[model samples]
Target: MIIIYYKNRFISISESESSTLNSINIEFNKIHDINIEIYKFLANNNIKNLHLFGKNPEKILKKLKKSFNYVKAAGGVVVNENNEILFIKRRGKWDLPKGKKDKGESIQITAIREVSEECGIDPEFILLKNYIDSTWHIYDESTEFILKRTYWYTMKYVGNEELVPQADEDITQAKWFNLHKLEKPLNKTFLNIQYIIELFISQCK
Candidate 1:
């Protein structure tokens, strides 16, 4: 199954009938293409989510992107010596530090650079580790719909420097959380954000 998020709403692609009673369930097949009507149906109704059945979601997702622009991004689940995780509160929502890729940048460095920039941590203090996972989400940019594909990495924080949240970037605060305490902050976070963090933690365990 593939789940693509749009703000708090989601488009779930699976073979089973969706559990979302309020969802707009559409029957799809490999031979037929998803069209603007289905996309607009989700947008117009302020529906919480969509469930597509009887189709290969992997291929359908590729077709969905053709209707909008896509953005590439990278971020890190920064951890410290105590195994506490670094987190930022952006626009009152709990979030990890991340940003878009610059021209000619490697995905690995993009994760490191975004973490440092958004959290105001010195590059020398953070150690990059193996990649964690990737997540997909959709949002409507002013003129167009945007589908963001973010690469996530596991990073270790070895610095003594104080954490600084990038105010200019809309980050209001930055702090570390014990793995067990993650549930509190996560309650107010985006689904995709929670998904990435949990996915990383599961592997760490």
Candidate 2:
């Protein structure tokens, strides 16, 4: 299942009906201009939830991808020996270390490189643990809409390298927050980032 967040609302793409009430269900493939329809739905403040369900959700997702400029990104949710989570401040919002996939670069490598470059950690010291999950979101850029799918991985930071935020990326701070005291950063993070951390915590339990 995929839940794309926009303006604090959500569009769920799955094989079954969403549990959310007041959801605007859509047979998105039949719509000639999926992108325009999505924009209209998003613009309507009354419509808080949107569901696109089908037997083959992958096909529906593929169809949706064709309607916009698609991008792939990968990132890490890194944990240190002190049981703290690594986070970065990007453009004043708390965000995990992530970036777009380079040409011909594997997603796993992209995750490692992004964490290394963004958080000033050595790629060798960032040990990839397991796949976490992926998230989808849409944003408008100039005249085109961009659909980004970010793959996430769980990682462990074994070294005590002095943290440095990537200034070129507008990351002002790179710090680790105690696992139990995450309220400060989580409150300032994007919905997708919160979802990733929640999903990761659920898996850990």
Candidate 3:
């Protein structure tokens, strides 16, 4: 299953039909033909999620993603030796350190560099560079619409360093949160962040 966000509405693509029948349950292949109807449903209705079941969900999703402007980004979920998680308060939400990929830069390095730059921590401080998963989101920025694809990774931090949030980036706070007390911070994050965390844990096994 894949969920793509379009503003406040979400389009969920899956290999099998979901149990709950909705008005917008259609094959992903038919999306292009009835895109206007889908948009109208999203705009006029107050629905939370829309489902599309198909055999080739990934192929359909890839095609649908091209309908808008797309950009790639990378970030990491850094964990300390004590099992605490690194988190940053960015734009008032609890978020991981991540940024857009630099030209000619590898995606792996982009994840390390973004975390280091955003938290004022050294790249070497994070031990593991293993990838986790990628998440997709679409949002409107000012007058323009954007589709952001973020690649997530699982990193380990052993060094003792002070957390610093990049002020110029609207990051107000950076701290290591204890795993047991993650509920508060998790509540302050985007839905994708939670999905990323869950995916990272599953992939680590």
Candidate 4:
């Protein structure tokens, strides 16, 4: 199954059905442009969710990729010895520190570099532990549709460092929240970030 988010809503593609009745379910067809179809679906305020299923979901995913400009990004879920999670506030919304991958830069390096640059932590102290997962989202930019795939990593901060949110990036705050007290902050973050955090927590359990 693959899920691509657009703002707070999402469209899921899978080989089997896994959605509620409120969702718009459709079988995949090669005749229609799937990416444009998704854009149209996102434009409708009434469509809360969508599910597309077929015998070959991989083929559907492949076709979906062709219609948009692709962008690669990387991020981290950083934890400290105190069991606190690092978070940043960007444009009034809570977010994980992430940025676009530079040309020829390895994805792992991009993750560490972004975390270090955004949160004022030294790259040497931010140790990437494991590849968590990736999230996809689509948006419009410069008269084109952009499909951004952000690779996420689980990282440990070995140093007790003060956070300095990258002000030029419109990051207002960089703070650590205890795992037990994350309800409010999670509520203010993007859906993709929320999903990543939940998936990470589930794996730990």
Better of 1 and 4 by lDDT: 4
lDDT of 2 by residue, 1-205 (tens): 8788774677788887776888977775566777777778767878888888878888878877887799999999999999999999987789899999999999999999999999988898999999999998877779877889999999999999999899998999999999889999999988899999999999889
lDDT of each: 0.84, 0.88, 0.80, 0.89
Q: How does candidate 2 fare on TM-score?
A: 0.90
Question: Where is model 1 more than 4 Å wrong at Cα?
Answer: 15-21, 30-35, 41-46
The clash tally of candidate 4 reads: 0
Q: Write the per-residue lDDT of candidate 4 for residues 113-188, one digit (tens) a residue.
A: 9999999989999999988899999877788878899999999999977899999999999999998899978989
By lDDT, who's the top model here? 4
Q: Which ranking of candidates, highest lDDT first?
A: 4, 2, 1, 3
Model 1 steric clash total: 0
Q: Residue 131 of model 2: what lDDT?
A: 99
- In model 1, the clashing pairs are none
Better of 1 and 2 by TM-score: 2
Task: Specify the poorest-scoring 10-residue window by lDDT in model 1.
Answer: 29-38
Model 2 residue runs over 4 Å out of place are 29-32
RMSD of 4: 1.6
Question: How do the residues 43-63 of candidate 3 rate in per-residue lDDT, one tens digit apiece?
Answer: 655766777788988887776
TM-score of each: 0.88, 0.90, 0.86, 0.93
Kindly give the stretch of ten consecutive residues in candidate 4 with the minimal lDDT sum: 29-38
**Model 1 residue 169 lDDT score:** 92
